[model samples]
Target chain A: MTVPSPIELVCPAGSLPALKTAIDHGADCVYLGFKDATNARNFTGLNFDPAQMREGIAYAHARKRKVLLALNTYPQTGNWASWTQAVDRAADFGLDAIILADPGLMAYAAKTHPQLRLHLSVQGSATSYEAINWYHERFGVQRAVLPRVLSMAQVESVIANTPVEIEIFGFGGLCVMVEGRCALSAYATGESPNCNGACSPGKHVRWEDTPRGMETRLNGILIDRFADGERAGYPTLCKGRFEVNDETYYALEEPTSLNTLELLPELARIGIRAIKIEGRQRSPAYVAQVTKVWRAALDKLKAGGAEGFSVLPGWMAELNKVSEGQSHTLGAYYRPWK
Target chain B: MKLALGPLLYYWPHQSVLDFYADMAEAPVDSVYLGETVCSRRHELRLEDWLEVGKVLADAGKEVVMSTQGLIESESDLKVLRRIVRQRAGGDAGFRVEANDMGAVRLLAEAGVKDWVAGPTLNVFNPSTLQLMIDAGATRWAVAPEMAGAALAEVRAALPAPLETEVFAYGRLPLAHSARCFTARHFNLQKDTCEFRCLSIMDGIALRTREGAPFLTLNGVQTQSARVHNLLGDLPAVRGQAEVLRISPQGAHTRQIVELFRATLDGSRSPADALAASREWMVEEPCNGFWHGRAGVEQYVAA
Candidate 1:
């Protein structure tokens, strides 16, 4: 067994309670966004406001854990000031680092707060080492959260080349597309994750119950319908079934969550610096359960190394309960999934 | 305003691609961006062939620009990109290249290519990113396809310096790209093992919602809108924001679409007249709602 360097467990915290729960569950760091459209999870009733953000930071810092602020959305032309202000807020709140997607925002943060650390958000759509290095060269980005598209070998190759620390999605809702490059949400609804920080924004969503099934539509575009006693995932555009070549199916991808619990040893062996859990829109109970499971898995890996590590059944069951569609996949990490 | 024929986003027969550009030699377009911007597996026209095609267009009194692939997934893909960058910067220095992704941007900037087109996939929504592109030596940049007219105006107003702006004026809007090839998946084949099925469909295969509403078009890895995004009706507003109007190449009647747009820009034809003339040429319905800051699939008409 090889000596494993401890990898940071970056958990999501949508609220103050989630932040504290993550820290208490042995998260090395908890990442979150603000209440405004400046961050990716700009859903109503989600994310931290200024007071909660300050409180969350204090809670994490007191426990010797890091708090990362995600200002991961691209600022529109007229709204550039708000994103810049968000960067300033992160610095003022004494955040351990700012996870940013926009190069323009990164430029602002790098110039204004020279002391603050920056992690390239997955929304940055940086897949290769060259792209990550460019962000590092231009903005002094210390870490990069890679888009969930690379295979295992590709991930290893990227980590081998770049000095910037690499982070990969370990668990959560799967985005089949390269994060920052997608415009499907904009096509279906005028709002996009890159511009509006929300995909299939709540305002555009409409659900109806028919005698045939339960129907979900976004911007009047019928996304999906669920039959009686059938599981219905959130009607994200990509996950819905569509007809291609006369057959109706999930043409892009199925409604599934990415679970990398089985690949923990391989990820560690490849020298990934951090493992990220994606869903700030979820509940605090979810944060607690996932954080606890991941914490246990990571600790077990640390104790036993690659040769002895194995994912426990209880941990898998715990994660499955909260996974989208109550199912899990390795996503693009496994070559077959691609 | 200038008209540009964007790089072909579909796979076609080698002869058809050659014939298409050969036809473009006589078409009313100011710039022709030549390349395999979608899948790198498409080698019907290699870098050398594309350069040869570029030379043909250049000699025909049209500005030629080569575009790199939007998504680079493998070492071979990067190698191809590196070769394209080297050829553009070194031997084929007469024409410019368009950087589609940040990888291409970094490569172009690193190779000291001073003047290049920042393609739409670079995601330049605000002026700061556009300014950064200018600083990195991009002489021109295309606005992301989803940017409305008001947002475009706002961005243009806030430019750090006068940079050439291009807009996606016509054709099916490319909505998303992924690692897994939807085309291959449709054929029930793995990406590596799939016989190039994208070659069969000159245009991408149509994806409709289960309710049979035309929704998206699935190419190999890229997903596009089922409806063609025609901004010809908004030429007056677009001309105010962008110096060049880009028309993405479609399966058929591209030259006619280019002619109609050219005539509209020259004021020989009214936008409504041009819109009516171009309707039969489009594979799908027309939509300009994205330009109006509405859902892209919608066609909003002002009362």
Candidate 2:
């Protein structure tokens, strides 16, 4: 049997401390956004500005670790020039790769900065090999962040067919809907990951102490209600409980973060190029813990053959402690969940 | 201005879908978009049935176009899209292909087709993106449902002449698409064994708020607005922006709704009169908020 090459461990860094922490904890590459709406993780007071990114990139490069910049949000006609300039700036910075979602931005980067590497953001919504191949052929995107929607078998099939490198989400907040294609956020909040780089935007998110329960609404539309003792997750539209017929249940998906710890061995066996950790909106503590645990797991998988590898229980406990939904699922990776 | 019937976003029984198009053949519409752009499990009418339906509408002197699935997940879905592209590539069918997904766009690019409708799901927000798509072969493009009319006026002004613009002028707006099937989840079943529950809901299933306000509609893997997007009252704003107004199909009164829009666009019916007559045809509250540059669910009637 052939020995599987160790997969690159790409981690998220919302702040400078998080970037340093990820690099210290053995992340091969740290992906972050600017302090504006150019990237998907456009939260308040998170991510790096130009000077901060310049320092972060310098720190990562000095340590022989790579830095990825996300210019992922789709820009409308009015403010598209700003987005284009940001793309050119990323090229000038000499970053490892620029992750993007919009076709317009993708075209600009391909034409203007032909030498820079492009990674298709999950928000690109290229679920199949055919779509992945299109991005590769047209925009010269080197890798695509697979949406959290494919089964493991599907992922293998896509990898076998396409020349583009594969990047799968290893841990963090999971989007139940396909990224980029979803507008449930914008429908209620007038903002989406596609245009605004935020979903269930914090400005529109409000919690009220109702007699029924603690109700969370986005722009005045109810998302989820938590009982007094129940732990409330962040209010995104797809994760909310709503009335379908009569019984109000999670009509789209129950709140659960995707933790693919057990699939690391399988993912490595399938020759996946990188394992991406989400949640740049999370604190440095989260980026540290997630990167540390995944680093250990990947090391374990590499030490032994994939056939003898098993997920350590200690890693599971560490991850669930930081999980948003108070639980974890294999998500669409487990065929039954898909 | 030309009026195009958008592909049916909901799953219907084989007969009802056939009947809807039979009635549409005589309606005052310029083009007909036929196919399952939603879920692949919607097999009441297969690829052949859609081709037959397109033939009927084309015979009635309508420019028929076939649309591909918006989120192509599996190889099987791609196989179906390839067949649709091939059928038209032969140049015998004379059907225009709507590249809803990037996968479909890739296939269209491979076929070296003359023209395609860059579907609303394609997210063509700016003029440069639209221009690049036109360079590839997009003859007409649908504006994103979230896009404002003011933004569209700018994009139209930026673009060179001869490109047709279409807007989602009516229907429950298709807000999102996902791999997980909501309709199957409603019945407590997996997507693999979904039993085609969407067939029962002629229109998509209405998802009301806990407070009993209509919020969103679940159509298989796709989510749409509960309020129907009606732009008849906003005809003054729409007239300059779009050369074609695409009305998405609904369960009932679609033919009448098309005629109302046609009469309004042709100046035979007053905007207020059209809105008044359209009340009975609507299954949900009418809104033109997106065109007025506000929240999509709001009516935003001009003062």
Query: What fraction of the reference interface contacts is present in each model, in order?
Result: 0.75, 0.61
Question: How large is the i-RMS for each model, in angstroms?
Answer: 1.1, 1.4
Could you give the DockQ of candidate 1? 0.79
lDDT of 2 by residue, A30-94 (tens): 99988888989889999888899999999999999999999888887788888988888898888
Q: For residues B1-303, could you state the per-residue lDDT of candidate 1 as single tens digits?
A: 889999999999999999999999999999999889888788899988998999999999999998888887778888878887887677545578898888888988998888899989888888898889988989998878898989888888887577788999999999999988999999888887769999959789999987898999999989999999998887877888889999999988999999999999999999989998899899999999899999999988889
Off by over 4 Å in 2: A1-3
What is the C-alpha lDDT profile of model 1 across A1-338, one tens digit per residue?
66556999999998888888889888999999999998899999889889999898888888899999999999987788899988998999999999999999899989999999999998889888888899999999999998888899989989988999999999999999999989999999999999889998989888899986998898888888899998866789999988887898888998889999999999999999999998888888999999999999999999888898999999999999999988999988877787
Q: Which ranges in model 1 have alpha carbons more than 4 Å from their true place? A: A1-4, B91-94
Winning candidate number (DockQ):
1
Model 1: per-residue Cα lDDT at residue B109: 90
- Which residue pairs show backbone clashes in model 2? none
- What is the C-alpha DockQ of each candidate? 0.79, 0.70
